[model samples]
Target: MEAEKKVIIVRFSGELSIKPDAEKYQAIERLCKQISLRLSEKNVFIDITHFHDRFQIKVSEQEVQSVCAVLDRSFGVGNYSLVDFQCSSKEEQILRLVPNYQDQFSGAEFRVRVKRSGQHSYSSMDLEKKAGAILGKTAKVNLSFPQKVLHIEVINEEAFLYSEKRKGPGGLPPHKRERALVLMSGGFDSAVAAWMLMKRGVCVDYLFCNMGGKSTERQTLQIAKVLSDLWNPDPIAKFISLDFTDSIEDIKKHSSLTYRQILLKCKMYEAASNVSKILGCYAIVTGEALGQVSSQSLQNLRAIDLSTRVSVLRPCIGMDKQEIIKKAYEIGTGVLSAKVLELCGITQGKAVRKANPSKTDEYLQSLDQSLIEKAIQERTEILLKDVDGKMLQSEYLFVDEISEGYEVIDCRTQKEFSQWHYAGARNLSLRELLANLKSLNKKKKYVLYCSFGTQTPVAAEIMQQSGFQAYAFKGGIGKLRSLQK
Candidate 1:
């Protein structure tokens, strides 16, 4: 007459099981804490007990589905199942429960799988045979390949019976390893790189060097938040943003034309290293893949490494671009990353394929190191969980085309606008637009365009913050002109 007991069994990854006793204990404790946090958000409470290689969560039957979702996305969880639990492993008690699953065995071939731990009166094979015989009344037995698998677990004085097993993310628990800083660009590669490191038990924070102003910073932070809220269980994930526009400009002005791309990477590395040191991160993680870009070439990467004191870790170094993209989609960052435009086009001419370390260092020295240092010093840090939709509202401040009744504003200089501008587009330089903001009609929908589509996003974001409906034309004037044709 006792109520049927339902529990969720979670098997920890093999990696965690192989750790030293003390490390294993700590890892399990952290994993449990993480699970509790994730479940608490959904109003599901659980009583957890750890076994040798797995853990059991006692929850109501109604909460099993929600808990299963948490386990599926959580790192360090190998697999999980919802099972009926009995306090006693007595053969008669298990036999009584066997008939309850007859409906599952009907019209299918099934085999019983028994796994035993601790001192048990019956062997696993004996239990499997007994259970299969009971299930065989309604189903045919197929040892090699069964359409249905009824699993049983015996430990000491308890028994668990289940018919379904779900796979988990299957990696070491997060925060067990040293912390690292991911140089996130709000792109597919960097976001996936962070997830890969987290899967390996590394606690990762993000460092965003903002080259495209506030809009880029906001978008990047949004992407980092997605990774943290979904994959990372640790509450200490921090996102640091530094405006690198000045440092990039410095490189453009003084650095060699051919070495601009490499030099810019070196500057980013230097900033990341400094920030990593301050934050106590052991390494700087990047999304660089060999030959994926001009600056990511092997020689350029090596030369760029010379600029930073901290070690660099590229999780995506050997991964194909398509492979990385697929993973990005799997980890829930692909859609967000796809919206982020590439803003690091510093290379004006053909960049050096194999950069010379000495020359790269010399060019790096010619620029103002103070700019990089100053940006690092003035960087803003936010816990990933604190990021909200208001911060990411700028993502809506972009339009790909000019539609009917939409007023287009060209944010170029007078001479540039006079030479060639969109038909019926009002010419309002960035400075003039800002100066006349109060006089413009608030009810009209406005679209702004600059030379390369980078600057107008900032303007559009500012306008959005001021309660105006505005958007920046994507791809700048070039794409807009193409669309016109």
Candidate 2:
């Protein structure tokens, strides 16, 4: 019988597939669960027939690319291919699928490979020779150094054929391993590190210390969300934002500038440790590359690590910046991380490489424990989702209220502001506003505006939290312009 049906053959990574029988079986089960969870989001149904040496997934032909995208994000998949078609166990059936491989092998040197299981009268070599003879009519056949390879799999009474295969994320399925609290900074390093842990099957929850303002909080939360969506589909990863403004102020006042950077990290570890206690996670992850900066020096890192008793996992400790950025791009966080505004004032001066532990302890002892406790007490949790799909519940200022007593702050770049802006609107970007937080007239009410309006509410929330009368301009500048016209 000859019938064309769409199927995918999934191969597990060597690391997971080579485990002991029981462990391998469990890992495969975890992978199957993840596959089903992630694909369900696309409204695509995947039917898994069995799991042994390979997984057989059947889906609609239209969803092949979508399935491949989801499989690329999954950790346990080593490689997968969309079978061109399935046919009965016969040599003539193989010839039917040969026409489909012409475009791929037409102008290139190719080879035919065959694999078989169960009863087969003909040897694998015999099948390969017969197929290669017909396929060579379309292209040159090079048994070695071929540009393309046509693969054939015969199992029981069925046979599958495909020309291309794609590599997967190649790690354990997330949540199959233990969970950890990652000190996510929304930067290249920590994002990549969190991804690394997730690749190894460790479910990662994000802990962000809001060092700048609401912008930083939103950025970090969004970054964590990106990691969460990539790693785990179920058991939504929790993003905890700690208001470190007071703590940042304390460090700036008491600690020397040279040590401010290291002290900030130490405080982060302390806060993370406390958060870990509440979450029941014993491990912490960071993006600290060894000697990447003064704060990441061996001595400074030791001082920072001493703040928490839990195991600190640094997957990128030996990698350089370029490598981490490349991984970030590959995993889909590069563009978002690149857009995150770098808020100034977290580190005011050059950091010291060799920080003494006793001195660090002295600085930690001098800080107000009440403020640290208060920071944790005021922690906010943001559940990550698509912006338009979720109701953020942020307060807003309607168009009619703009002319009242509110001072309008155009949060767009100078280039955009120079083109056209609201009358008497003062241009202050998110970056400039954060850097000049102390200089703002907090006595006056303020309305923040952005290009698309998606970002203003976050800025407004930060201002409100800092005791300022602030609200996001409803629908942002786009709506405001339409109202004026």
Candidate 3:
């Protein structure tokens, strides 16, 4: 005999259900399109039928697990279940199906749950009591807590029997809200912030300011791609990258020592605002939490806001650092984000805790605006869903672990290396490495690491252009220690 066919039942989120009828319809349609696209990408295909409160998808038993995984990552899906059997809503039909489940429920505590939507001779309570008694013959019935739950849903003239319900991300569908641009840093904070906005129905595109050259850009893209392919429901999300080396240099030369960090932040805000206009984004999203860092203090944030005409949205403003990291891991960006090193080399001395708005604006006005405009004009835009691991790996600029037989170079000061260094690592300052590049063996692979993972990439790129195999260790010293442990 052929195996019984299975179907997936998807319940819409409560937020989506409360929208106007037209909006609710559009949201459901968008959700269905998202599901179809995601499954098609995975080579799974199915037909979806929409009901008043749920969607039913017919799939073979083999497709059920994969389909459920897609639903779990999909927004606007409240919960889903795999239907084991279906029959007429009559009490007798349901009772007959109940016997089929006894073998699995035997020796375990089980409970019967019934949800009815249409007029019937029997109410949900009546059906639950009857189903529970039948299953109790083989298993113990625990109303409070059961190891197994037998679910029965009666809609009109049909009944669906399922074992357990799996949860989804549970929010409104993507593109249901206005589009916004996110300042992505490929760290736990920005990634989780972008996810929060995506969960709330906002369509998000990323704007990455290149501070650490190709390594940073590649790592950031990898992180953004995860968010795009896994969390985002819309495929139109773009990753916009712009080189900011010259801009940072300009700020360093002209800005006050204490104000450079704040000035650099303002410059980013200005760039994001300019790009947001061209992209038609109503607001700019940031991962900044209040007082998380000196530049993120309420006063400093207020000063940063002064540089942008576009509205700035801080979804993570009230969240603690631990909370943000937890959410990042939950959304699948934690591992990738952890690989990103913080680029704070531009700031010298103590950064201003409460930057004066006038001073920030004055310093920002002194920098060359032409360079910012030029970077914007020459920026690279990528449709994120089209990106894959092979494409990202083509850069060959970063490594998570140092393989045996590879020469490890510690690109920190002699004093710092003496304090602590990776085992079997040679202490070579960046200048010394570049100076001795010609004498180094081209036949062997070299891994370079610095305190912050900033200079190693630049050095690695130079070595690569000179015909040497080189890579910067990802996440700098902090991540290196974790790997060792």
Task: Please name the candidate that would achieve the greatest lDDT relative to the true structure.
Answer: 3
Tell me the alpha-carbon RMSD of every candidate: 13.5, 10.5, 11.2
Query: What is the Cα-based lDDT of residue 296 in candidate 1?
Result: 85
Give the per-residue lDDT digits (tens) of candidate 1, residues 314-404. 9999998999988986776665677688687788779898999999988887899689878977888998666644455546878887899
Q: Select the stronger candidate by TM-score from 2 and 3.
A: 3
Tens-place lDDT digits, model 2, residues 337-374: 76567542366566788999999999988887787678
From the highest lDDT down, the ranking of the candidates is 3, 1, 2
Each prediction's TM-score versus the true structure: 0.78, 0.78, 0.79
Candidate 3's displacement at residue 67, Å, is: 1.0
Q: Find the number of clashing residue pairs for candidate 2.
A: 0
**What's the residue-level lDDT of 438 in candidate 1?**
99
- Clash pairs, candidate 2, are none
lDDT of each: 0.82, 0.78, 0.84
